[model samples]
Target: MSSVLYQSVVKNYGALNVLRSLDLAVPDHMFLALLGPSGCGKTTALRILAGLDMPSAGKLFIGERDVTRLQPRDRDIAMVFQSYALYPQMTVGENIGYPLWIRGMPDAERRAKIDEVAAVLEIGHLLDRRPRQLSGGQRQRVALARAIVRDPAAFLMDEPLSNLDARLRLTMRGEIKRLCQRLGATTLYVTHDQVEALTMADFVAVMHGGELQQMAPPADIYDRPANRFVATFVGNPPMNILPVTLAEQGIAIGGTPVAIPAARLAACRAAQVVEIGLRPEDMSVSVPGAPNALPGEIYVVEPMGNETLVNVRLGGGNVSVRAGRDFRGAVGANIAVTFDVSNACFFNSAGLTAVHRVNSDGE
Candidate 1:
């Protein structure tokens, strides 16, 4: 069992606390991404797990061993950093075989392992090339090959793809995902990229201000965010959040009623002022006088190749609606928007709606 566990881990620097009693569990062979923006203590947690930094308090375990004070090498972990960390003077083959060489493996065995890892990563043809001679993606693969050759108990990756171009990053995301599945190693990947975390990880632990905000599979994190921060951060265009008053009629924005499911309204009846969340995809331009139509002026329109994003100034706040590519609505034009209440979310003023509320049909 190669599960990585952090029990009430805390890291502090003088008076400034970095990590605040974080308790996390990563199942065996699980690919879990510690995701957050820079300075959120995600990297600190990864460093602690890798034995590069010591925790201020609490136990760290890799499998059944209490590795809280173990050295990096003694922990039997492989780390791939954001820099690729390839040696400029060494060939790709040498780089991949370095760990085995240090372990006193025979040259023949080292060469065989290097060749195997190179072939697995599809970089066998470039084994003779130096780090500088290879492209960014190839160098990244070389770094990965080096780590994989170790066959360590766990793999720690710190923003390993942050250096690649956008196209290469997308390509490598799939490659990394395939590699993790093929090896079935417990991997702890640290990255600020939400797309990478959402698409690759078996589970995602969202960190904010050195605290664990939420941990769950990607779909649940998106559809039902644990709090306002997660709700606003995970989405691409982000959910449109508005301060509204809940009443018997429905939700009201700027004192004007907006259409919402009766069941949702009833569920949040205890809260007077609630923050309503609607994904951009759930809103559309509706015909004037349509049922539950919200009148607003188009603030701006962004035409993506596949769809158009239209920002509307509704009452005191602004909300963006995702429209079809054929949408030719001009900016500043008065338009009506309709809501899909089935997918709506309601949060208290403090920004917490623990359970997702059902619509009228109980969906």
Candidate 2:
């Protein structure tokens, strides 16, 4: 496996811009997930990498070889699409070994490879069965087995597990991650689900409005977002972004200065207007005036058994606060919210967000 680079690639559709000067790098044997909401161009990026679509401008490389103009078959890459893309007429064994067959591999070798992948994928029992005989997850495994049989230079997966239920998706997530590790194949995965991106990939590329915003490890993207868009889009409940003003006394959120230790306030230089980004875990309900505390009302309570998400309204907007194992809160109840300044992130007036220190708390 070798590095893959998309050098300032651009794509357009008539009057619409699907990808804007997108540049990305996936290291050898690295599992990279392209994450963003629908219409963000993550799918388009995967298509370009697999050579199903050519870039309007800029170059693409697989290892050191340029592949910008290469066709899908010429790129030596296997792609697993969200639709499964399986042939209804083919048996599971034949489906899995289709790639090897296309390359004119000997019958004995093809059978050996099919048996190996089928055993790994636990689909050996279903080899004689057609795709319709298997469940969604089983069919997905067949799709993955096809990709693995060829031992291509890389694998491009486009939301291959979106159709499975929650439990099945979780099971398949571990299966795919473990398979990729064993094969040491450089994989570029595309998904709109943040949890999928966070849990499955070694690194994540967060995209927005067809532009690449940030690319880093999952923990880095979650704890230290490059900007507000990445911060809000990459988390489970997402980060809480609020408008604030920097006054001479301290920081005023919604016209009220939050009480914090003098030592902490002293470090912040007053800017005309600054916004604060807080994770749900950053705010705690506790004694008033206990280090950056603000009074707010609990507007919504969503119980998850292990944790309760309390939505608090303050500064003209509502934001969720995560409570420990089990903390009770009712709607319209007044609560004292205190921020863990050490875990806080700051953004400028233009809403360009940056985590204050990646090594602070949650380091």
Candidate 3:
């Protein structure tokens, strides 16, 4: 396995900018997920790395080799496309061995490698079946097997599980994670799904508007987002941003004083914070007269299987709170929600994170 690097990469289409000054590095054997919404240039970045597309500017490297201008066949990388592009006329064994065949490996050796990879992916029994005869999940396994059979320097996967049903996606997620880990492959996986990115990758590089937002371990990305965009984009229901004012006591949310740690308050004051972010899981429903609570009316209540999500309309904006599954509340009902101010995030006028609380125990 080898490391992958993109230095000052840029992609442009006429007047439109698809990627801007992107500098990313995936260390040897690390799984890095390029995560963003549609048209965020994630796939474009992947294609550039795969040699299927060239960057408008900057350098691309696989290990120490410059591969920016190399042909796709010369990149020493295997790609698992979203479509699982298997030939319908070929059997699974043939599909998996195609890369080896093109490379002029002996037929017996190619077949042996195909069988070994097929067994690894639990698709050994289906090697004789054609693509049309296999299930979607099976076809996906074949795609993965083909990628694995090459033993390439790195792997590039473009939303390889997007076409699978929910259960199949879940199953494939685990399978892919384990497979990559077991192989110790340097992988760059592109997907718009936050769940897949967070669960499968060692590091996640978030992109927005053709620029890199933040790249970090999943836990750090979720708990200590670098800016308001990242704080709002990563979570399940997303973080809630509410206008706030510096109060004499500490900070004010909707005219109600909220107490925060002295250091955090001082940091907010230093940065001239304008807004506060609260994760749904960090806030809770409370009595109307609860101290340090923002009074609001319940706007909606959604009962998720394991927890209830309550959206409350505060004076400044609506904020969702994750509550106990059995908790019940009616829309328009008077309510107050409270959160640990230390756990909240403060953002400056420029939408950059001003202050974020870290656990005293050094998590």
lDDT of each: 0.88, 0.85, 0.92
Q: Which candidate has the highest lDDT of all? A: 3
Q: Which should have the higher TM-score, number 1 or number 2?
A: 1
Those runs of model 1 whose alpha carbons end farther than 4 Å from true positions after fitting are: 271-273, 354-363
Where is the poorest 10-residue window by lDDT in model 1? Answer: 353-362
Model 1, span 1-363: residue lDDT tens: 299999999999999999999999999999999989898999999999999999999999999999999998889899899999998899999999988998999999899999999999999999899999999999999999999998788999999999999999999999999999999999999999999999999999999999999999998788878788888888889888887776678778766677765656777676544777888988899766787777888899999989999999887589989999999987888888888666777788777754363444666
Name the weakest run of 10 consecutive residues (lDDT summed) in model 3.
Answer: 354-363
How close is every model to the real structure, measured as TM-score?
A: 0.95, 0.94, 0.98
- The per-residue C-alpha lDDT of model 1 at residue 271 equals 58
lDDT of 3: 0.92
lDDT of 2 by residue, 1-363 (tens): 777999999999888899999999888999999999999999999998888887888899999989999888988899898989988999999999899998999999999999999999999999999999889999899999989988788999999999999999999998999999898999999999889899989999999999999999999998888888988887769898887766666678876686544544554453333667889987777654455677778898888888888888876478888887678877787886877666777776666763363356534
lDDT (10s digit) by residue, model 3, range 1-363: 899999999999998999998999889999999999999999999999998888999999999999999999998999999999998899999999999999999988888898899889898999899999999999999999999998899999999999999999999999999999999999999999999999999999999989999999998889889899888889989999999999766898888888877877888899999999989999999989999989999999999989999999999999999999999999999999998887788889999888885654653
Clashes of each: 0, 1, 0
